[model samples]
Target: MDELMRRRVYGADHDDPDPGPRPGHVYVELVGGPLDGLLLDITGWPQDRLAVGAALGTELGKFGPGGRAVYGPTAAGPGRWAWEADSP
Candidate 1:
């Protein structure tokens, strides 16, 4: 599994620093939903609009960083988000 994906294997979201920066990973959560587990990071995307991707069986993505494309599953969006410490 990719380093990013590996970090998620723990089944628990880890703590992140800054919450906004290159060294930081993006986390995505629905504006209002019930499902909550691993908060998906939505930073990999460009900084401009709200990108929409998958999370907890829901389709949601936010656009940021101009227009980069960041996406993931909602089923894993809720808790604290952090990189695997060795993510490429």
Candidate 2:
């Protein structure tokens, strides 16, 4: 589990204050199981309070029990989320 945040480009022109560590994407990994070492890049979902939850649900649904695993945001900050399966 990892929270992928956009890094500031030193040469980019911008007027807004640095949006420090804004949530960009999440990388989920399964540990110690048949699905171990599998990685999922969950992004492009609606960026809202429920984005992570929605993404997790969608992925798990697609993969089923084997998809059961723990995950966390790529970065640590507000709105960051984590989930774990009952088994596996």
Q: What is the C-alpha RMSD of each candidate to the true structure, in Å?
A: 13.8, 11.8
lDDT for model 1: 0.34
Model 1, residue 25: what's the lDDT? 62
Worst 10 residues of 1 by lDDT: 79-88
lDDT tens digits, residue span 2-80, model 2: 2323433212236757532334644444333333344444445455633444233322433664444444443454333
lDDT of model 2 at residue 67?
Answer: 45
Query: Each candidate's TM vs. the true structure?
Result: 0.25, 0.26
**lDDT of each residue in 1-88, candidate 1, tens digit only:** 1433433321242364322222366555323332233344555566443323432322221322232222333344443322211111
Best by lDDT: 2
Clashes of each: 34, 5
lDDT of each: 0.34, 0.39
